[model samples]
Target: MQPSSSPSKFDNMPGDIERRPSVEEALDHEPLEKGWWYKPHVLKLNFLMLAPFVTMAAWGFDISMTNSLQSLEAFNERFDHPSGARLGFYGASTQLGGAFTIFVAPFIIQKLGRRAMCLIGSSIIIGMSIMQTFALNFNMFVAAKLLLGFGSTGVQIAAPVLITELAHPRQRERITAMYNTTIYVGLIAGAWIAFGTQDIPGDRSWQIPTILQVVLPAYQVLTIFLCPESPRWLVAKGQEEKARKILVKYHGGGQETPLVRAEMEAIMAGIEADATRIRFNKTDISALLSHKGNLHRILIATVVAVGSQCTGSGLISAYLPQILDNVGMTSTREKTLINGIINIWTWIIGLGAGYVIPKLSKRSLFLFSTSGMILTFVVWTALSAVYTQQGGYSYGIGVVAMMFIYNAFYGMCWLPLVVAYPLELATTKQRGILFSWMFFCLSMSTFAVNYINPIGLENIGWRYYIITIVFTLLILCLIYFFFVETKGLSLEEVATVFDGRENYDAAVSAVHAVEVKQAGEPEEQHVERKDER
Candidate 1:
């Protein structure tokens, strides 16, 4: 929240034509909120929110993995056989690549800004797609997968911030949902494309689907150049004036300009006020860890992220076709098609749930999702045991039903909530850093899950489901005690909630006041960009 003294000074202050700091200044004083989503420029930026799905499509790349595994086998014949260690890297590279991006994104955002960083990532994706098409050996394949993972990480971290920056509070959930929805769309698309290309004879089959992956990122690169840089970031660097012009361009006409300007000025006053109170330094682990509240928020974020990955979702996804094959599926193509159908419906329902979450208590929704996971795991464990006991077509059919049901429930709950929770918790100043680190932990968890699955299934018999079920129950306990409701709250309000310094109502009101103040202000006229400053 803005310091008490700062708001009092601005409460009755005169609007000056020349004294206002840039957009960055105001945002630095206040925080980005729901109201900002209403501006035209901000709204237009939502189109690029589709980028996450593009990254997520890589997850569904496994739709054709059976074919790829065959291709891997064929490629290995002329060369050395890829070890489990090496093969593990291929599976884990996507998340490992994500970790690399998480570690680097904060610094990159600090240097190039979010817009430039997103564009660079998009370029890497397009380049990686081309490279993957030509990879001949396991090492080259690993390099291609790593590059693709890094590119996806850029999208994963940047998309939500972009949407949060560009959207109004009323539209935030919907806009964010668009990003989440597109990812599922990407998954479905990857499944169908890879599925369709499965029988084209030789390595040429994989090339088509791999090359098709470049289309979305290439479009994102083009779009980023046309879109405005984030107004929040602009405000942070003292580019108040530029930020204002963009706001005006987005708002159009003068109808809302004065109100927007007033909010901007108030925001600037608050930021300038806060700047006077604190030291300026690059955001880092030390800064975040030094504060107890921030530490709590980080712990919550890490657990949520890790939990999302640990629910056995990645394991189910990686081995879907193989699972189907085990369950007596007739053909790979048929299985991929059925899998795509399940995924599409699952996401459609999941997106629906995410849309409603903002209206419901975040805590309640978190509990509900956690409960669904617990139930899903219980069922999964029972089904695994049943299949072990019976071992026939009946058990295989039961396995199919269990798989479909798990994906359906999972997509509706865990998928969106995991991403939504972290985005809703962190402060604007710490968001990029927090989300990146969250993704880092998520990637690490993914690496562990994917690496352990082959070994676990081969060595443990039927113990994997039992182990995962236990984690789901533990996560449910975490949600009940530590997680707070963030629905309808602005980012700054979320910051307050995490800090535990104020009552829920008061903290939310404080954040709302700050956001409304920022939204209603006009952009400052002569502020410097980060580079210029």
Candidate 2:
């Protein structure tokens, strides 16, 4: 029952090592299915998962506030009607703040636990929200935005990694799906709040929505303490008993079960064999680049991170109101209303995608989503050209309709899989680097898109969609050629997809042995999260 501080037991299996069933094939399903919803401990774990879900809402609110505020006359007047680069800089500054965190993030992830990062992120954003609400000048407002990016980027970096590590086996895919989608919920809240207060006479029109930005980050702060740190992180830090008890509650549903032991064994084997650990240094980076498998994982991480923004969603996210203006839908109330409606639509589509996510392979979903977007953008861009040249209201309206279609296709897969796919790809040893790099790419691409989008629309009109159209097509080719499917595997088992069949056989064999031999052993702790609640 000692922690797996030593190398994996199966490194030198006697005689010929036998191939073994994967965690997916060996998983005990009957116990997990019986009254799953009604189980109290299980119910509590689900509630705790909400901590990460709300973090994205904080991000969504910022995006919505940016997009909505740009359309507001009062906000424009207050900021002296920023246009071109000044306007672009305002939206892109947050990503600049995010880029600043890239190097230090790995050190923090190594030392502090995941929950600590989440808490720290939420606390930072709360102060920035207040700073933004009462800004004395545009300079003060941009400063708030720069820091808001820093805070929100911290939350974004940790939240999905937390979800991928902490979610129940049955719930991981769907929970991760729902996590990113919460941004749309935050979007809806920000959009409607701004819309609701738009008619007010003065500064309060923008101030109300800006100040209310603290809502979700504050909620994350209050609830994050309820969330357990990642069990995988615990085991790597040599706290196996605490890790075991966490798995027992969330993975085993209270008691020590075969499934829980299998997961723990697999995790230990992964840490031991793959050098997954609590510390990071130059060596981890070397290891990350040393293998073709790890290189492939990094490649996919880049695609997902950059692709999420490049698929034209970034333009809509930062410049939807301008997009509306481009297509001749110029009324402030109508623009904000359309923005609010699109948020609701994307949220609904996001929830629907959750059920479908569990059913499709990751490769299949990425391909389908990208293809759908390519088609939507082609027609969307063409319609915008018509609007620009002919000046027909129907052409403008058609362009608006295409945004809805584009979001639906994007929502089906990219919405959720951006973080989940990249996290799943990285070997545990390289998770921190790949996660940081993924977000770094995301922030930079989003910054580039957000910064360039308004200028492109202003200078070139409808032609801006052409750039994302070309980028998204390249993304689709990458998915078809390079992406690996990780649909049915447990988190530990996912390493085998990158590490090869030899390590796969050893890891799976160890899990089976542990599950059989340790199924009857007494746990050091059990159902403790119940008390946490």
TM-score per candidate: 0.80, 0.91
Stretch of 10 with least lDDT, candidate 2: 524-533
Tens-digit lDDT track of model 2 for 346-381: 889987997678788889889998999999999999
Check candidate 2 and list the clashing pairs.
none
Give per-candidate clash totals: 26, 0
lDDT of 1 by residue, 1-533 (tens): 32122233234332332333233343454434546555445555454444433444444453234234433323445336553455556667777777788767776765567777778887887897788778877677778878777877877787667666655444566556445555566677766666666666766566677787777777777777566666666766768777767656654323344335544543343333331121235443445466666677778888888887787676666655445554566565557677667667777877787777667786786677667766866776666666667767776677667767777667765777767778777655566777888888988898887677656665654577788888888888887888877776555445556554333223223433454455574435334334312
Candidate 1 wrong stretches, greater than 4 Å: 1-45, 48-86, 251-254, 257-284, 500-533
Model 2 stretches with alpha carbons more than 4 Å out = 1-22, 25-28, 32-34, 276-284, 507-533
Tell me the lDDT of candidate 1.
0.62
So what's the TM-score on candidate 1? 0.80
lDDT of each: 0.62, 0.79
* TM-score, model 2 to reference: 0.91
